[model samples]
Target chain A: MTAVATACPPAVRQGGGPVPVVSEGPALLAGIAQGPGLAAHLNRLGPAPRPSLGALVDMARDVDLRGRGGAGFPFATKLSAAARRRAVVVVNASEGEPGSHKDAALISCAPHVVLDGAAAVARALRTQEVHIVVSSEHPSLRRVVEKALRERVTAGECLDLRLHDAAPRFVAGQAQAVLQLLAGRENLPVTAWQPEAVSGHRGRPTLLSNAETFAQIGHLVRVGSAGYAAHGTAGEPGTTLVTLRGDGWAPEVREVAHGTPLADLLDEAETSRPLLLGGYHGTWLRPAQLRGMTVSRSAIAAAGATLGAGVMLPLAQGRCPLVRTAELVEYLAGQSARRCGPCLNGLPAMAEAVRALVHGEGSVRRVEELCGLVVRRGACAHPDGTARLVASMMQRFPAEVQAHSVGTCRRGREVSG
Target chain B: MSEHQLRVDWPACKGHGLCAELLPEVISLDEWGYPIVHEPVKGEVLAMARRAVKACPTLALRLTLPA
Candidate 1:
């Protein structure tokens, strides 16, 4: 609703890509070597009474952890205010952002690590049902995760986790939309209801957080807040898993310490051009400003954007910013569930405007009007966020936008032909 | 909140308009015949909201509380 940007706070720019070696904590590798998760891990912890809602709150607070899910809400506060005891735990594994491969990659590589996190949180919250919500694209991930949970049962791990197939549409990955589909309703719904936290399953409480967040939770528990806080910035501690895609980069999942500099990650990717931070729903940063830009959620927010889902994409110099930005906007629009009045009506209109700009056939008036309609009107941030991204591109890359406008850009070539 | 709201899945609405007839104070039909409920529901409207919800001939209308 309001464009708010805070000036620089704490920041860090580090080397290495995602999956940076976590030097502290209980050693996730140790847990991995035990070769027993769910049940074995539970057995190892042994009869530890589930932390009181209060105790769990304290741990979350002590760690200063935030939602690894894009919002970055304080985990402690989310736990405290969320419906307690009766809440359902939804592990978001949709991995819908084209630039985002972190969730699926994590589950594929270390299924048990994620499971340990899910189990720990559910146990801590005393929730009986844990749903693993994944997309149809990653069928193996679903099967493997399910099989891993099954194995945990043999080791006496509490087996309350269920694998749910969420509609693979991009909009379905939004937190509320994901819940609606899990409720056995259409993936696209007009209203927002709390399924996992409120009236979940048979109308109980629900705690829906992303798969990565749960993995972080698992790390926090094994290492304790103090150990987990050892890496990264003081304001933002621990490791972050990001999906690194684009030029000169090893296209793989990476683990980096929190507050790693954006410049460093791009250097790891070897990207020589501008970078698109935060995925399609994220912002595009020019090469010059990359220096000293940190990766913490707050730091990015201060820069008027976020590192959503920790997605890092690079746009080479030869690539036209206008074309790339337009394509991404249209891609995001097509992903909308078309439930709300604004998303359904607004997105397509914005898409057309972007297309016209791409072809050098758009008017400034049309673009401005479409952008205005895209905010605060959807069940999720898909429409609003996409609009912001496109609008920001238009604002920040004025030279490119003007080039397209005056028929001197790539879009003008088609017109001349 | 005495006044309540009625929502229809536009795809499911089928333009039944039963809610409009059953609860005029809250609902009005659109040009195409779909029901548009304009009344803001409050605490006291829960009973009426429930009635309207049940009365929808197509079962498209629902009464929901904010979380």
Candidate 2:
């Protein structure tokens, strides 16, 4: 296979990091991109004082702040549910999703803002305990968060904030897994009929959200729901942070209004090529499928894909999509938590089938069968996500699959590893 | 008559296949030997499904009222 070098757009680096771009809206990123320490955060966003629990819930409902984690559950519902009992707020900074860098970016640059959001939720719940769970794998992020916490303490914020280090597995970032880690258990998901919001983190109620979600909460409280809603579409209000990658361009974490066109971040010329929207667990959108599509969750869903975790990866040209998909499937197989038989056996089997397809030794029917068997059979969503991604690749690129089986590939070469 | 459904706590299940052997009417073992319930439990077979749930060595099987 031809390993053509992908061209990346030059990014303006601020304070040794990529500056967040806010195109066509007010900036929620405000002062965070310049690697601002706590002082700049205070100056820009000010201290996030806790509103009453009732008021916070009302505002969350009014603005409809969904969880920034891959699953877009309504934040208000989660908060109100957990608030019924003594609840702890958890800031899920353990970003293990491939192609997602917004969480770590927020932690490193504007950690206090994230802390402010967490503190707001804690106050609303009338709990001083707030846990910030970061992956132990990221020492730099740990240091940055610790430094931010110290700054918050020195500022006399009445928060019982604790920093926790969790194993960096993709499933480990799930709500149950994060809660388990916080309770000194292994970072693994457990099947439960009840939502974690009702009983979590040592069986007490818990309000957990992604770092970016908390940051948006801080932004929302600061700007109010109306001001936040002023920027994005009617359905999905407020700005969102998206990790825009692919097409040989340096992946950028951009803060754009919810309804910003996908074409704004990706080249319109390249939109015809299959774009891997969201991350690996996300879906592929065909060229015509993405035309006039906005980056909102509803808009992306309307295009037959999810805006999962707010990741946008447009496939670069001249690359074998099947080969890339096979490689990703292999990676995903390695990432399986192995908590369920279906995920353990099914993902690797599907990956192997894809590998065979990439080598022109397999048929599309085999892949489809594997996907049907794998989806919805795991303890977590990993297997289902992998199945969705693979299914989308097959659905969006049937011609490519047909060509691959005929001993020819779009790249016109054996792309097999 | 109250309708019931079979559920498996996948992590707790160890592919013992006892559930399938006992209640083959609804549960069958996949290629890997894990039990896959073909349909929800209903009618007089509910007692048989309960017996299989009790027979599961890992205690991963359960019958619950359909939501």
Candidate 3:
């Protein structure tokens, strides 16, 4: 670990000793919100340690740092891959997933923590070129990040950071699409599957990950591996932010330790209705299946579901899940990049078939067949994800499928859709 | 000689279904008329699979061993 000369700009404790705004967690979100400047962050966490590449890689592996983005790929592996033939590091803060605000929350509320992490990773990789990709939907977020970049620059830290505004589309947040967007090309996945770490933006080896992952890297630097591991479970250590959304309540981004019960975060004793784990490309779990689950990735994997990018929303009791499923499928269908025939033709066809079912005029067999055809047939996993959501809807709620099939709802009333 | 798998360059394929027509034994059109390689092209079908790749209008189909 190397400590550079400090120009931390007079530690004044911005809001009188960092009162936690969004969350009061054991890690990252601890003292996240500040009033206006970097004084509070500098005073609280001190300057983030500029660990050498070897040290950062070892620390990442020791603390089990996984990308906070949807895929949750190992950060150490990504770093090591980037070490060879890599020059660029991209901070993906697009936060395009529906009902997901955790990354956006980090960028808006705690910009320094994210910026510090990016600096650490970029410096360790021995490259100063860092690009931050953000969606234009949140002008305020862009403003906040811009302010943070200036603060880091004033602090005499040198990481040539450039922020690019991107369209707020679902696929726009994807790693490949991000590379293309940065290059001023169309934001869509290419037919070829080139590992971004090997050949990324400008055809150089690039280290691209979710914005929150870099924030966690900052946390990992402040509190070394052991301190970082203090909060979460042994298998998956450290705290993670979850954006909780439901029918009655407005969305809230809460930072909780890994291995916390999924039910506990839902703020309910137990829900009888189904839940959507991960984001749209995630899984649908029946109440019984989700009851025993924790936030640990391995635990979720043990049950054959990925705890993807952490968007938890339970279907309200009164609402028909199939109706929601149909709506979600249509949304996902519209999100397809339209690069391939299977996704282009299959998604719209699947959407129509699902819409027909919701309106009481399609077969379960037909929907299943469409799901069968669309899986693994795209440039990206968009079609497969949409199909998985549909399949899970069918599996989790058989009675709902039956009711809609006979031109009636689960309540035995006429299917009103 | 190395064995190669029949594959589709997803973003390029326009669903012309010519690959399906030329190599029906290995490639078949799905409900959407997109080619789905049912099995690996081997022995007897290898020659036909090469012809199918050459026949694709958009040059979207490939017969290459995956790396």
Candidate 4:
């Protein structure tokens, strides 16, 4: 109902912000491994065309643009909700998932694209302010973004860019958490729901998106919607940026066309081991199941998995996956904000159950019960996402679970507690 | 007559279980002893919801009967 928003003063405007890792599509990651300098970004993408607010929304809808922050929520819908009300752009670069590094990759390699999109949103909304939130842990990334902002200012672009360092924790990247951190409060999500578009950013409508979502917007502005739609399937336009890891190799960022075969991006012949899609909050699929799967939201959903913040880990064949999953659950449990009972209490209980099962100390039924108890119970999707990871691992690898229960891991693998 | 709604401030609710006892039709306790809102507290169930809200020791249960 209100289109007026006051910009909050920059808090430690040097380098800190939200932690959502980006799944920047190929377009966003254009000129791979290139310098994040303003001149390089300008040379690569050319000048971004200014579009009316209405035109921007239509562009997003035309290409079926979805947030690459992992939820895949249609970007157009969020744009429309905050269209006329107000705008303060918050970019999530936190990479909350421990395994994800795509957002940081973009910040390090292409900071301009993220800012270009963030500034465009502010310019469209007439707010003229944008905030890029990166993890406090990444000092070099902070320097990179700081350098990018300085370059933009030096180039005579009159945009207000504020950088704030935030706690480098999983939930710290949630939009609500970002807002809270910016407010200098404890970084925890509120229980009651006011859509950020309704009352975000100090109680004014704000456009909140991951760094990659803004990268997509930046590309959309550079190329009209059609040009942007040139890549990927008609259903899911644009390429996808995926962070590929596992097998003890250093994590790498790969950009591929939407719906590109999962087999293509990953070395399928690496091992016959099952792969985990969608990071820690994602599901595990057998190699056979992952064979024909594609990277688009619809295809990933069809494969009974999510491209969760674009992390794919194909485990090393010799590692006991059950033990690995147990460790992950324990980590997730510790990451809980601890405001909701189900998440706060249930996660540790679930972790205990999974740990027990791994050590031949308990039954899978307890794990299943804990999973059921936790879903749809927390204030945020953290608990539900955690449950999904646990439930899927149990369903996907019954043989592994069975072996763990019998105090043995798969043949040739030692069960480590 | 407009519908009534029930919500729990999860962080505030101490899993006292009184809400489940009073408003059994709309509330149930999970294994962790947390109250889960299972149904809408409208129609005849509104009265039960009100009792639960009043009896809530932590004063965390909220019943939003339309004004």
Candidate 5:
């Protein structure tokens, strides 16, 4: 019922903040390299690295690349277990996270790069099949990627690159659910006793990754580990794309080096308050603590948070974190596929609790207990992430929650921090 | 080992309290009129869960197995 200001923040505020990565410079926008510049530059035009399983593993190791997806699973580790004969490669473009569009932007602006990565993985695994699952909302983008795959096929890339339209649900993008859909099963989470990665997609070993991860692989292949490592930190090398949005913040994609300090990024974005790092599933950190804070997963983890798909939103002193958290929780709860126990049950429970607190009807202690219960009981990370997001907000905005509890907070008024 | 679970269609759910009314032990009605089915009944209780599912006026509740 509230129509708060959703306008993007200023492009450049005089003495306000540092420029966002998306706007700091022109997007380098590198496509899949056909020839060699660094790494094992092997494509049609480039000397094809004779598809050795060990070589592919070594290549991934050299770059120290991890899944660009939210989980940050190791790419080399995922590839090592996926050498089965019926191995399949899945390019996940479902990208259902709200206020997050980096994957779509990557696919739309540079489809070939993602295709090259998919093709390389298929070639590396000696598999004959590759599938790209995109959201139905982005039909044109899926078309462009499919066309790029066809063009590559004509150029002698001998692999079956299939395009699949994912069901328009948030959890449909989940690894297991996506696999179920790909296998022509119900478009819901699997009920398998075994892990989906090892026994997925018609009882075959499937390698599913975000669209950005595959493109990063293609980039790593061409740039070489050392070259890719040049800009990022020692642990996680390469640039990461982040979606920055909020009041007094322009909504745009930004490419920051893996170890870019959080303070610098916020300064560039011209945010004038404490920031919410990661996505709705991420954490809230003091702005002063952001000083000299690195943006890598390890660093974020060390700081008691995870840079989930690189969604950074800065809440100035006025925007009520309690209200914002409640709104976000409601949105996330609305997006659940409702296939699991905790997510289907706990999220709505938690959302209601938070809503009651925001509307001055509940206690924070009850909300905390609910948060503790919901974190680890889901089939996917939705419940856990939602819990973490809401829990962090509750911790960070105790004052707001207290005010709401005391029935003094005027939630109807247009309030900003 | 089969596990019992609750499933919901978030967009389709209008926060009706019917599911909680049908199965009070597992599902609780929240302030927003949404049912919070905390514990999903598997095996024997699944029948009761299914009955509750059938009783949902909004048709939002379902019994499911874990993935």
Candidate 6:
């Protein structure tokens, strides 16, 4: 019951030119190439029929549909957890991850798909209210969502859809943080005694999922589990949207089937360089680790990395990976909610240590020690994620670390000496 | 009987550091004066941990069993 006075860090606008939807499969982004509108959405994927709660759960379970959000929790498990009580469907469109834009892309290019998914979830849970939470920084996305909701109403959908504007912060998109915003409280995360699915949004059962997850649900309902599972691997089914970076321009949001090879999305010439799978908080994959790795969750997990928010940034040649990692760590440290001690203290300390290492003024052992202290010590996963990024950089770039320590850098520059 | 564990509601904790002082074995203060709990309270220290929980100024510290 303590109120800590903390200022919201200014939102870092995601760079990368307009992300285009490139899909191998015909679901989710079916008519994106032809410029999808409400009409196009309706024509490509017809109006969704209200299915029973049991049926929706069965479909999710049958396809093993995991949330498109970073954690990849199964959708069926979350749905069944909320089935016992009056529930509210929350569409988490707050795309705050720096290199992730699939949610915004979905809302902008195919708002109907997202709306249809939200409405479908509401109908399944027998709740009339569906709240789509987007960042206040993106006014255009808000307009698109509002217009799409109106379009759905005009088309005779009876679900009550609302748009909520969240302050643009990294952790603001976390489940608890979003729920706090809906509760008219400060948009900060709290360690809930009960899961949100059990008691949330005014103590009622709430099913909150990523925007792409809802669109996938809309896709799932339109096409049965068998059809949705047609393209992806056995473990992870359906086509997923990915924000692909480091191909010479801003990251492009592309839709690829689950089993697509990592090589397919990346530049073949740059395969020798380290590939950053997931966004800033995700792990780095060496070229050797990329072999035989597909885009599916199981495959990526087997490769010791996660397809976190499905972001891939191939580090450009001639750029120092450790320097890039230090820069991102600094950004993540600044984005902390500043409520927790580890995040407030540990992150800045670790960021400074990494910066010193980059400039040949710090020790690798000190950076590692700081990372160990920061992991699992914060209220949210922000500290843990930052540690993961730093740890992975240390593991993957030993040569670079040795070079940087001696006052030289991989980019062939005397950064310190 | 289920074993008691020490937990901190981090947002509520303003680094009062009473828990570390009262239950030195189970809790230690970080560089910023916040408690870094060694979780899963041992049977011998459960009483002192309870005292620490009661002694917290902000009531940010709690003793609970695993759910």
State the lDDT of candidate 5 residue by residue for B1-67, as single tens digits: 4767877654356666777777787888654466666875866667778898887776766676775
DockQ of each: 0.13, 0.72, 0.82, 0.67, 0.08, 0.68
Off by over 4 Å in 6: A1-25, A34-36, A246-248, B42-44
What is the alpha-carbon lDDT for the whole of candidate 5? 0.69
Q: For residue A28, give model 1's deviation from the true position in Å.
A: 6.0
Worst 10 residues of 4 chain B by lDDT: B58-67
How high is the lDDT of residue B40 in model 1? 67
Model 2, stretches more than 4 Å misplaced?
A: A1-25, A246-249, A414-417
| TM-score (0 to 1) for chain B of model 6 | 0.92
After superposition, the stretches of candidate 3 with alpha carbons farther than 4 Å from their true spots are: A1-21, A246-248, A411-413, B42-51
- The interface root mean square deviation of candidate 1 comes to 5.6
Clashing residue pairs found in predicted model 2:
A7-A248, A8-A248, A8-A249
lDDT tens per residue, model 3, A206-296 = 9999999999998899889999889898888898888777212455667788998877776564356678887777788877887778888
lDDT of each: 0.66, 0.79, 0.79, 0.78, 0.69, 0.81
TM-score, chain A, candidate 6: 0.92
Q: Is candidate 1 or candidate 4 better by lDDT?
A: 4
Model 2 fnat value: 0.57
Best by lDDT: 6
Residue range A1-417, candidate 1, lDDT tens digits: 011112100011112223211111223333333333355555555433345567677888987777777777777776765546576778888867766766765565455667777777777677767888877665555666676777877767764778887776677777766776777887654444443455555566667788888877766766677888887878777888776672124444566787777665556433456678888887877665566777787777776778778887787546777778877877777887755555666777788888788677887678877676656544577877888788778766777777777777752343332
Error of 6 at B62 (Å): 2.3
Model 6 C-alpha lDDT per residue in residues A213-269, reported as the tens digit of each score: 999988888888999898687777789988877223555667788998877777676
**Which order, best to worst by TM-score?**
6, 2, 3, 4, 1, 5
lDDT of 2 by residue, A348-377 (tens): 999999989978898788888889887666
In the predicted model 6, the residue pairs found to clash are A16-A250, A17-A250
Candidate 4 global CA lDDT score: 0.78
Q: Which ten residues in a row have the lowest lDDT in candidate 6 chain A?
A: A1-10
**Top TM-score model:** 6
Model 1's CAPRI class is incorrect
Off by over 4 Å in 1: A1-50, A83-85, A193-196, A199-202, A246-250, A268-272, A410-417, B1-67
